[model samples]
Every structure is written in C-alpha cells, then in structure tokens.
Target chain A: MRGAVIYAPGDVRFENLDDPKIINPTDAIIRTVATCVCGSDLWPYRGAEPIGDPHPMGHEYVGVVEEVGSEVANVRPGQFVVGSFATSDNSCANCLNGWQSSCLHREFMSTCQADYVRIPNAHGTLVATDEHPDAELVPSLLAVSDVMGTGWYAAVAAEVKPGSTAVVVGDGAVGLCGVIAAKELGAERIITMSRHESRQKLAREFGATDIIAERGDAGVARVKDLTGGIGADSVLECVGTSEAMRQALHSARPGGNVGFVGVPHEVAIDGEELFFSHVGLRGGPAPVRRHLPDLIDRVLTGRINPGKVFDLTLPLDQVAEGYRAMDERRAVKALLKP
Target chain B: MRGAVIYAPGDVRFENLDDPKIINPTDAIIRTVATCVCGSDLWPYRGAEPIGDPHPMGHEYVGVVEEVGSEVANVRPGQFVVGSFATSDNSCANCLNGWQSSCLHREFMSTCQADYVRIPNAHGTLVATDEHPDAELVPSLLAVSDVMGTGWYAAVAAEVKPGSTAVVVGDGAVGLCGVIAAKELGAERIITMSRHESRQKLAREFGATDIIAERGDAGVARVKDLTGGIGADSVLECVGTSEAMRQALHSARPGGNVGFVGVPHEVAIDGEELFFSHVGLRGGPAPVRRHLPDLIDRVLTGRINPGKVFDLTLPLDQVAEGYRAMDERRAVKALLKP
Candidate 1:
C-alpha cells in the first residue's frame, strides 16, 4: 500500500509501505476511502513541530471496515464508517463522559494515510452509517474524523445558545465548520473573521451572518459593533497565535465564553486580564468521537456538506503534493483518495 | 471620625478623619457598627502590595445608615444595614445579570475602616434584616458584608454541585467561609488544606469533612486519593499564590471547575498546564452586592455563621491594633467596633 510518511521537518513523502493488519482483538482493519491533510499536520510539515523519524502520516479518514476483530461487537466488516482522529475504548470513564479524545485507552490513528490501517478500540472509535451512501458524501464523512467534530466541539464548549452572537477567529476549515456548528446550535449571529474568499464564501453558505476582514483591534471593534458594543456572547479561537487569542479575548462580552480549540503555541494568559474580563476559557483536544456519530448523520441527511473545505484532491501516491499545496497556501485543505 | 489608614508598609495608624456625607442622590452615609480587617488587607500592610500614600482601609462593614440621599428609596436613615464591599447601581444590565461587581456604576468600598463612610448605589449595596437582632447577630451581619458574600461567590464560581467533592486551597477567613458556602450549595464532601489549628477548627465547623496538611503535589495527591484518584469536582483557590493555583489545578478532576477568589498578585498562568489539565478557571472580584441579600438572609436565619473567623476584637480607637494582630498572623481576622 502507498502511504505518506514524515521523515523530518518539511519532508513529507509518499512511498510504498507494508499493509496494516489487525494486531489486537479490539482493532479493525479499515480500507481508506478518503484521507486529508490537517492544519495541525502543517505544524510539522512547516518545521514548526519537530519531526523525529519516518513516522506514519494522516489521521483523518472515511473508510470501510474491511475486517473486524472478534472483540468489536458494534461495527462489522463491509460497513461504511467515519472514525474519529483518535481511537478510543468506549468503556473508559472519560469516554463514558463523552470525551473520547481523552479516553483512558486511546491511540492516535496517524497511519490512516495508507490504503489499509488498523483501528484500535474499533467498537468505540468508528460510527457507521445505516447504509452506504454514494461517493459524493465521502469528503464530508472524511471531515467527521477531525475538523467537523472539532468545530462542533468548539461550539458546544463555547456554550453557544439560541439568540446568541458568536465570533469565529479563524477562517480555515475548522472555523468554517464551526460556523455551521454554531448555526446548528442556534446562535443568532455568526461572525467569521476571514481574509480568504473561498473560506469566506463557504462560511457564509454555512450560516455566517457577518464577516469582518480586519484583524486585531479593528476585528474586535467590528465584533463589538455587531454585538451592540457588548462583544459576541461566544468567541471561538481556532488560530493558535498570541494575537489571535488576544483578539478572541477582546471579542467576547464580560460574561461570555471563549472556546479556544487552537493548539496554543507559546500562548501567554495574563491573569489580570482574564480576571477583569470575567470571561470563561474552555476547550482542549476536542472530543471528536462524541460528535462523529451525529456529524456523520448530518452529512448523510444533506443538512451540511463540509467537504467544501477540500479545495484540492489527489491519489494517495501524491499525498506529498497535497501537503505542498497546503504548505504553500494554495489549498484550504487537500483530500487524498486511497 | 476615627479611621484606620495605611501610611506605609507596616505602618497602619488610627487617626481622626472627616466624617463622610452623602454626595449623590443614591448615596448614604453610614456610621459603622462593626468592621473587619480582611485577608487581602494584610497584603498591603505586609508590604506585599504597594502602599502608595496614607490610604483609608477596609472594604467590610455592618453599619447604621445615619443619612440617606434623596434618591435612596429602599434604604432610609437610622437603619441597621449590611452592605457589600462593592457598591453598584441595581438598575444596570450587568447588575441585573447578577454581576454587580462589574456594574456600570460600581464603587469599591475600600475607605470603610472609618467611623463614618459614604455608601454609593445604596439601593443595591445595603440589605437590612427584618428587625435589628441582639448583639450576637451583629457579627453574622458583618460577615454578610464581604467574607460571606465572597465565599458564596467562590462556591458559585466553582460550581459546587450536589454530591460533588470540593477542595479549598486556603485556610483564611474566605476559605473557611468557602467551606460553609460549599456546604450550603450542596457539596457532599469538602477538603480543605489547613496548617493552622484555628482556621482548621473553623473550617471543620463550617463543614469541612477532610483536611490535608500537604502543600502542593502531596495535597493534590491526598485529595485524589480521597476521591478515588479522580480528583475533586470543584476546587476553590482562595490563597492568591501561584502554588495555591497550581495545587488547585492538580486537585481538580479533568473537566472540573476552579473558582479562584484570591486577589491575584503577580501570578503567571501557564497555558499548557491549564489546557492539559482541562480545568476551567472562573472568578474575579466577588459580585458581593449580588449575593448580599441571600447571604444576609442566611445569616439572619442562622443558616451560616461566617463570623467564627473573626478571632480578635478591638474598639474603633484601637484600629491600629486590629491591623497589627492580623498582619502578624496572631488572629485569623480582626473585628473592630465603633
């Protein structure tokens, strides 16, 4: 099978690799239907996060269960499924609490870029559809693996309610999906800060009532203006930059919530500012498995088509090209079919 | 009028000062019945916080309204009243939202250590008992002025749900009151870290079921052990130290709430630690005015007695002695009577 591998920083390669097999009874072999590059993947591809060795790449995929271990009681072979970015044991206390991303027995599915991959804790990790849908729904189902679930988690974490105003900080795939999530959660006014036309257009299509192209103070001021000077009731920070985090902080009302899903990169939280602001900060690694089921259902029902985020597509053998397009800012996200 | 003023570090003096007079239509002048030195006040007296000039001290007091301005419709002259540390216009949106401390018209009553003090936004700040009780209830009413309200805010902020375990990180009066607040809020188990026998006794009396003498890691471990290694559902950091904050973080279960009421002093927050721990930090200056009514009712009904924290007592002329005792740690808190 051909798979993507990260040998070192800025060195993502596609080459023939050994096919994965079910190594544990709780694991299932998934034949990848579609896989994609993540913004977080750019962290290492751009040499921001250190890459140690020729590691297996990709964690987002919509696949068919080619084989299931004896212990996997919920999902069976030949079933179309959308698994979370991370595999989780359904019985763990954390998983039971609906935070499967931090399940006690969890493993990252980094090797999903290959044609076939072993999914540990398969019973809990994958959410299968009632029946197989056409190929058009593959990209949207693929999104269920990470970005869609994450964006949904951002909305849930922010406590976005009916008649609420929400500000989405990033215009990337997750932010676009977050706009959709907030709208689904009944937020009255959804504002996305975007300088990109493609993401902006998709965001508007996903129920964004307002868009502010300005950054920093102007962005915060525009959000405040949209919220009648009280700022948004909920602010979602999807970009992991100090300035972006600050803008998110300044974009929320005094009693509002800020759900920051962006991986904090050298972020400094000033205690005095947080104290005086009286805002709540919540959200970490999203509980993607918790949302995968509903998100996949939403995709199948034509409620939302998150696959619009994939601006480019390539065969699995050209995974490196997909990464290059994203790294060079040519695509919002690149989809790879295996 | 006699007042306690901080001229410099370790130099709190009792001296004559001009009596306060009503300035605003919503203002009232109160002759203090009883006032207490707070844990935060010692920071300035101990040279921890800057003592700029000879500043009038105290933010906690129970008094008689000697004069009421024209717009003071709710409160009248010659009434015994318990007022919060913060004075707020009850009509503002923020105040109506139960965050009076952040009200549009809010004034902190730091100059209330004097014999006569001006109370702003009298309609919102002062709450009176149905009838003036005996001398014993005066102490309880004094508690409602600040400490009790702060403790209740900490409990509310931490979200001490019923059947949940709560860990408090300080042994001061506020922490002791936090134990009481947690119990009133339906917390089943209260674990408090106390090295002092006096405060420990008060905490136990206030409903602390467990006490851990360990400081940071060990204290958190003890709490985890007590909670079957799951940590507490809620944690209250009342000691404004980075160590206490860290301990609070380590003591909470993942996705637990942390209500920090300690006035932060040069504390740096680590984003990674907070993010990985999944602890929600929420707090600020207690919305004392918002809780003053219920706290006063509780005190009057003999539901909670926060005045147990007042270990030392002094006359108005001996205001300096009250500061000295509290600053030297000879008293958990000092109560001064005019």
Candidate 2:
C-alpha cells in the first residue's frame, strides 16, 4: 500500500506503506475507494500546526469495507460506506446528544489518504449506503464523510431558518458547502465573503445570494450595510482564524447566531464584545456524524452536488501534488483516488 | 427630589436632586414606587468598575407614571408600570428580534433610586399593569423590572426545556431567580451552586432540586458527577467572572446551552476551550424588556415570588445602607422605598 506522509513543513511524500488491519473487535478494514485533501491539511502542510515527526496524512474518505472484526455489526465486507472524520462509539451520552465528535470513545481517523485504512468503532462511525455508489456519485458521497456534513452542521448550529439572511465568512470548500447547507435549511438570503473569482462563482452556484470581496472590519461592515445596518440574521464562521471569528461575530445582528465550525487557532474573544454582541456562539470540531444520515440521503437522491467542490482529482500516487494544488489555492478541494 | 450618587468607590450619598422632567418627546416621568440595589452595583462600590464622577446610582425600579411625553402611547400617567434597567425604544431591529438591551435607542435608567426619574423611550420600555398593585404584590412586580426578567432571559436563552437538567452558576438574587425561571420553563432538575446557608435555603425554595457548595472546577465536576458524567443540559451563568464563565461552560454537556446574563468584568474566553466544549454560549446584558410582560403577569397573578430575593428594605435616604448591605453580602438584595 502507498500513503502520504508529512516529514516537515512543505514536505510530503508518497511511498509504499504497510496496509492497515482491524485491530479492535469493533473495527473494520476498508480499502480506500476515494479520499481527499482537506483545508485543515494545509495547517500542517504549511507548518502552522506543529509537526515534530513524519506523520500519516488525511482523515476524510469514502470506501468499501474489505473486512470487519468480530464485533462489527452495522457494516459488512464489500459494503460502501461514509464515516465522520472523528470515529465514535455513537452510544455515549454526547453521541446520543448529537455531539459525536465528543463521544466518550472517540478516535481520530488518520492516514486514510491511502489504499487501506482501519476504522475504529465501525458500527457507530460508518453509515453504509444501500449499495456501491455510482462512480460519479463517489466524490459527493466522500464529502458526506466530512466537509459536507461539517457545512451542514454549521448551518444547523447557526440556526438557519426560513427567511434568515445568512453570512458565510470564508470561501474555502467548507464555506461553499455551507452555502448549500444554508439554502437547504431554507435561508432566503445567503451572503458569502469571497475575494476569489472562481470560489465566488462556486459560492453563487451553491446558492449564495450575494458576495462581498472585502475582509476584516470592511467585510463585516459590508454585511451590515447589506442587511440594513443590522447585520445578517445568521453568520456561519467557516474560517478558524481570530480575524475570521471576529468578523463572524460582528457580522451578526444583536440577537443573531454565529455558528463557527472552523478549527480555531490562536483565537481569543473579549468578554465585553461577546457580551454586547448578543449573538449566540456555538461551534468546535463539528459533530459531522450527526448530519451524515440526512446528507447521505440528500446526496444519493440527487438533491445536492457537493462533489463540485473537488475541482482537482488525482491518482493516489500524485497525492503530493494534490496537497500542492490546495496549498497554493489552485483548487477548492482535491479528490484522490486510491 | 432625592437620589443616590456614587462619588467614588465605597462612597454612596443620598441627597437632594432636581426633579426629573420629560425632555425628550419619547420620555416619561415616573415616581419611584420601589428600587433595588443590584449585584452589578457592587462592581462600582467595590471599585471594580471605576467611578470618575458623582454619578447617579440605581437602574432597577418599578414606578407609577407621573407624566408622559406627548408621543408616549404604551404607558400613561398614574399607571403602575415596570421597565427594564436598560430602556429601549423596542422599535429597532434588535428589539424586534428580542434583544431590547441592544436597541438603537437604548438608555440606562440611572438615578432610579429617587422620588422621580425621567425614562427615555417610555412608550417602548414601560409595560403598565391593569391596576395599582397591593403592597404584597409590589415587591414581586418590582423584581420583574430587572432581576426576575434577567433570570428568565437566562433560562430562555439557555433553552431550558421539559425534562432538561438545568444548573445555575451563582446563588445571588439573579441566580436564585434563575432556579425559579428554570422550573417555570419546565426543567426537571435544577442544581444551584451556593455555599451560603441562607442562599441555599432560598435556592431550594425557588425550585433547586440540588445544591452544590463547591466553586470553580469542583462545582463543574460535581455537576458532571450528578448527570452521569455528561454535565447539565442547560447552564445559567449569573456570575460574570472568568472563573464562573469557565465553570458554566465546563458544567454543560456537549451540545448544551449556557445563558450568561452576568455583566462581565475582566473576563476573556479562550476560543479553543469554548470551541471544543461544543457548548452554545449566548449572553450579554439581558433583554429584560423582552420578558417583562409575561413575568409581570406571573408576578401579578402570584405565580412566583421573586421579590423574596430582597431580604432587606430601607427608605430612599438609606440608599447608602442598601448598597452596603449587598456589597457586604449581608443581604441577597436590598429594596429601597422612595
């Protein structure tokens, strides 16, 4: 098997690696059908996330189960499935509360950007499709494993409602998917902040009613200006940076909601500002698993095409270039076929 | 007329002041029937909130309308009424969205511990009762002016629902009132954090099913211990300190909600912790006016006795003693008669 490894910042290699095998009674061995480079991957690739040693890459994938341990019951060999980036037992109180990412027996699914992967807690983490998906539907199905579900969580956390004006604070793949989620959730006016032409086009296609090229305070001002100086009713914070979080907070009306799904880095919120903002703030590592069932249904029924976010696809051997394309902003998302 | 002034920390003076007159077309003059010293007032009295000049004190009051500006319509002269500490026009987008504290035309009702006070935005701020209230009903109705309404907002914002386990983080007047609000909102289990015997007694009377004397991490740990290690379903944060906020966040189950009505001082939230907690945080100055009508009804109908939070009563001339009693923790609250 061949997998991608990051030895250092700007250092990625694709080389032969040992295949994964089910070690736990509840685990499943899956032969990767498709995987992708995540926007979060850029954090470690660019050295923004500390990396002391070479590490396995990728946490997002849709695959066919090749084998399952004795305790695996929900999924079987040869079944195609999509799972959340974070694996969970799914029976814990947190999981029962729809916060699977915080489940008691949670584990990170890493190195899935390879030929084979071992998924722990298979019965709880993997959502099996009725059958192997059509070749063209694979990418969209793969998105349900992470990005699409994350976007959907963002919309739901922001409480997007039938007539809400939602503002999305990023133009990355997740942000574009958020536009789709907000639209599906019945948001009437979707405003996306995007400075890139291609990304803006994708955002609009995904149901963004307006686009603002501005950043920082100006971007927030633009949102307020568009919403009659009261800010949007719901703001989806898809970027994790402090500035992005600030913008998201400032871009909401006094009693609006800011659903922040970005993996925050070096973000500090002033109590005074948040107190006065009167905006409901909720986010974290998205409980993507919570939205998987519905998103999978929507995808299989041809209701949404989130797969369009994967503008770049490469063979597993060229995973290095997949990382490069996304790191350089040449692709919104990179789909890798193993 | 007479009012209380804070010339400096620990310096409160009750002295003669000019009678208030309706200056704005939207203003109304009200003769104070009852005013109270708030937990928030201790901030200035303790020198936590700087006082640069001899500023008027008191912001919570229930009064009888003495005169109404020509444009005022919702309230009229001689009517017994209650208004939020923060007066709002109630016509702004924020107010319409249920965040009256952030209304475009918001004015803090200072000099309220006086014989008469001019209320701005009276038409939108004041809610008049059907008739003059009996002496016994006056205290409870006065609570609807601020503390009770704030507690109700905390419960509502925290999304306390039927069968939910709710936790109140402080045992001050507002926190005790939160227990009552949580019960009224259909919370099945109410846990209030209190170390003082008197406050704990009041907490129980207000519907606290359990009381935790621990503070900070221990309190949070106790809550998790009580809820099968998952924490409370909803947490009402009535103390504004960083420690209290942190505890409130930690005390809630993942995906739980925290309604914080504390006037924060020196509180800074770490974005990473909040994001990972998966706790919904919504707070600020309570939009008390939003809950006034319903709270007033409950008070007038004797459904709740939030006024019991005021353990001491003093004449307007003893306003300094009222502040001293609350600041010294000798009283949970102090009601001033003008």
Candidate 3:
C-alpha cells in the first residue's frame, strides 16, 4: 500500500507502506475509495505545528469495506461507507448524549490517505450507504465524513435559526461549507468574511448574502453595520486562531451564539470580556458521527453540493502535490483518488 | 438622607448624604423600604476591588415610589416596587432579545443603601406590585431584585431541563438561590458544593439533594462519581474567582452547560482546553428585569423564600455593622431596614 508521510516541514513524500490489519475485534479494514487533504493538514505541512517522527497523514475518507473483525456487524465486506475523523463506540454515554467526538473509547482516524486503512470502532463509526452511488457523488460523500459534517456542527453550535442572521469566519473549505449549512438551516442572512476573490465567489454561490474583506476592528464594524448596530444572531468561527476567535465573539449580538470548530492554537479567552459580551460559546471537534446519516442523505438527495469545495483533484500517488497546492493557496481543497 | 459609604477597605461608615433627585424624564425617586448587603459587596470591603473615593454603596432594594418624572408612567408615586441593579430601556434591541442587562441605555444602580434613590429607565426597570405586600414577604421581594434573579438567570443559561442533573458551585446567597432555581426548573438532582455547615444546611433546605464539600480536583472527582462518571448536566457558577470558574467547567459533562453569574475577577480561560471539553459556556450579569415579575410572583405566592439567605438584620442607621458582619463571614447575608 502507498500513503503520504510527513518527514519534516514542507517535506511530504509518497512512499510504499505495509497494509493495515485489524488489531481489535471492533476494527475493520477499508480499501480507500476517496480521500482528501484538509486545511488542517497545512498546520504540520507549513511547520506551524510540530512534526515529530515520520507518520502517515489524513483523516477524511469515503471507502469500501475490504474486511471486518468478528465483532463488527454494522458494516461489512464490500459495502461503500462514510465515517468521521473521530471514531466512537456509538453506545457510550457521551455518544448517547450526541457528543460522539468525546466518546470515552474514541480514536481519531489518521493514515487514511492510503490504499487501505484500518478503522477502529468500525461497528459504530461506519455508516454504509444502501448501494454505491454514481462516481461523481464521491467528493460530496467524502465531505460528509468531516468538513461538511463539521460545518453542520458549527451551525448547530451557533444555534442558527430560521429568519436569523449568521456570520461565518474564515474562507477555508469548512467556512464555505458552513455557509451552505447556515442556508440549509434556514438562516435568512449569511455573512462570510473572506479576502480571497475566488473563495468569496464560492461562498456567494453557497448562499452568502454579504462578505466583509476587512479583518480586525473594521470587520466587526461592518458586521455591526449590517446587523443594525448590534451583531449577527450566530457566528461560525471556522479558523483556529486568536484573531478569528475574537472576530467571531465580537460579531455576535448579546444573547447570540458563537460556534467555533477550528482547532485553537494558543488562544486565551478573558473571562471578564466574554461575560460582558453576553455571548454564548460552544466549540470543539465536530461530533461528525452524530450527523453522518443525515448529511449523507442530504448529499445523495442533491439538496446540497458540498463537493464544490474541492477545486483541485489528484491521483493518490501525487498526494504531495495536493498538500502543496492547498498550502500555497492555489486550491481551496484537493480531492485525492486512491 | 443617610447611606453607607466606603472610604477605604474595611472602613464602611454610616454618613449623611444628599437626597437623590430625578435627573431624567424617565427617572423615579423611591423611598427605601428595604436594601441588603450582597456577596459582591464583600469584594470592595475586603480590598479585593479598588475604592477610589468615598461613595454611596448598595444596589439591591425594594422601595415605595416617592416621586416620578413627567415621563414615568409604569409606576406612580406611593406604589410599592421591585427593581433590578441594572436598569434598562425595555424597548432596546438587546432588551427585546431578553438580555436587559445588555440594553443599549443600561445604567447600574449603585446608591440604593441611602434613604432615597433615583431610578433611571424607571418605566422599564421598576415592576410595581399590585398593592403593599405583607411584612413577611418583604425580604423575599427584596431578594428577587438581585440574588434570586441572578440565580434564575444562571439556571436558564445552563438550560436546566426536567430530569437533568444540576451542580451549584459556591455556597453564597446566589448559589443557595441557584439550588432553588434548579429545583423549580425540574432538575431531578441538585448537587451543591459548600464547606460551611450553615450554608450547607441552607442549601439542603433549598432543594440541594447532594452536598460535596471537597474543593478543586477532589470536588470534581466527587461530582463525576455521582453523575455516572460523566459530570452533571448543568453547572451554575455563582462564585467569580478563577478557581470557581474552573470547578464549574470541570464539573459538567461533555456537551453540558455552565451558567456563570459571578462577575469574574482576572480569570482567563484557555480556548484549547474548553474546545476539547465540548462544554457550552454562557455567563454575564443576570438580566434581572427580565425575570423580576415572575420572581416577584413566586415570592408573593410563597413558592420560594430566598430571603432566608439573610441571617442578620440591622436598622438602616447600623449599615456599617451589616458590612462588617458580611465581610467577616459571620453572616451569609445582611438585611437593612431604612
């Protein structure tokens, strides 16, 4: 099997690796059908995040089951499936409460950018489609595994409602998908913060009613201006930076909500400031498994086309190029074929 | 008129003060019927907060309207009323959104310990009773102005639901009232953290089903054990210190909520830690005006008795003794008669 491995900053290589095997009775081995390089992947690729010891990368996939452990009954051999970046046992207390990302026996998926990948807690994590769909739907289905699912979580956390206003921070793939989610959730107005012309166009296509190119205080002023001197009813923070968090918090009206999905880095929130703002905040890794069935259905039903986020595609062997294109801002996201 | 003035830390003195007068068309002057020392007031008395110059203190009061400006119509002269510490124009956007504390024209009441106090935004901030209430209900009515209202807001922000488990951090008057709120909101179990025997007894009387005296890590462990290894469904943080905030956050299960009412002092929350916890956080000064009517009704109907939190009562002329007792922790709270 071949997979992408990170040796150091900007040093990704396509190398042959041993095929994964089931290590637990709850595990299953899936032959990767579709995979992708995510914006989060750039964290290590750009040296923003530490990379220690060479390891396989990737956490998004739509694959076909090759084999299953004895205990895995929900998904079996030959079934096309979608799974979340974070695997859960489905029946744990946290999972029952609809927070599968915090499942007691949770394991985050990595090493998915390969021909074959071993899935832990497969019986609970994998949701098999009734039948394999048309090839063109692969990208959207793969998106339902992470980015799209995450976007949905962001909207839910922000408590977006019909006839309410929503603001999306960050123009990355997740933020673009968030625009779609907010629209689908019945938000009357969708505002996205994006400076890149191409990304702004895509955001508008996804139902953004307004766009603010300004970044700090000026951006907040624009949001307040649009929101009648207050702020939006909901703000989806899709970037994991202190500046993005501050913008998201500032863009919400008192009693409004800010749902942050980006993995925060060195962000410290002042308790007094947050209290005075009177904004509700809830953020974490998206509980994708909890929304898998509904999102996959949305994709198959043609109600939403999140696949548009992938502006570039590459063969699995050229995964290095996929990372490079996204890192250099040449592609919003790159879909990889395995 | 007479009032309690704080000239320095531990130096509260009963002094003559100028009578308050209506300065705005929406203002009303109320003759003080009752006012009380608050847990927050201890901060200034203990030197935890700066005291620039001698100033009239106190923000909680139940009084009779002595005079009304030309624009005041909701309550007329001689009407008994209950008012919040924070006054607001009810027609503002934030007030209409149920966040009166964040109202556009909000003004915090700070001279209520005096014989007479001017009320700003009186048309929206004062809720007049149908008639003079029995003397027995005066204490409870006074509590509704702040402590009880704050506790109710905490329960609401935490989203307490029927059959859910709730935890109250802090054993002060607000925390005790929080226990009452959780019970009223239909929480099946209420856990209160308190080290003081008297406060523990009071908490139990206020519907606290369990009490954990442990602090810090041990306290959180106890909460987890009682909540089936996950924390409580909702946690009401009534103390403002960093330690209290951390305890409240850690005492809730993933996806649970923490409604913090304490005015935080120099507290900073790490964004990454909060994100991984999957907990929802919402905190602010309570929108007392929003809950005034309901709380007043509860008090008058004998459904709750938050006034029990006041263990020491003093004549208005002995205001200094009231402050001294509360500052020394000799009384849970002090009630004053003007």
The candidate that wins on lDDT is 3
Which pairs clash inside model 3? Answer: none
lDDT of 3 by residue, A1-338 (tens): 99999999899898999999989999999999999998899999999999999999999999999999999999889999999999999999999999999999999998999999999999989999999988999999999999999999999999999999999999999999999999999999999999999999999999999999999999999999999998999999999999999999999999999999999999999999999999999999999999999999999999999999999999999999999999989999999998
- Could you give candidate 1's per-residue lDDT for residues B93-139 as a string of tens digits? 67776778877898988988889989989877887766776798888
Q: Model 2 Cα displacement at A220 (Å)?
A: 1.1
For model 2, report DockQ. Answer: 0.87
Deviating ranges (above 4 Å) for candidate 2 = none
Separate DockQ for every predicted complex: 0.57, 0.87, 0.93
User: What lDDT tens digits, residue by residue, belong to model 2 across residues B255-305?
Assistant: 999999998888888888989899999998889888988898898888899
Superposed on the true interface residues, model 1 gives a C-alpha RMSD in angstroms of: 1.5
Q: Pick out the ten consecutive residues of candidate 1 chain B with the lowest summed lDDT.
A: B270-279
The residue-by-residue lDDT of candidate 2 on A1-338, one tens digit each, is 88999898888899889888878999999999999999999998998999888888999999999999999999999899999899999999999998999999999888898999999989899989998989999999998888888898899899999999999999998999999999999999999999999999999999999999999998988998999899999999998999999999999999999999989999998987899899999998888788888899999999999999999999998999999999989898999998
Minimal lDDT window, size 10, model 3 chain B: B319-328
What TM-scores result for chain A when each predicted structure is judged separately against the true chain A? 0.97, 0.99, 0.99
> Candidate 1 recovers what fraction of true contacts?
0.36
Clashes, model 1 = 0
Candidate order, DockQ descending:
3, 2, 1
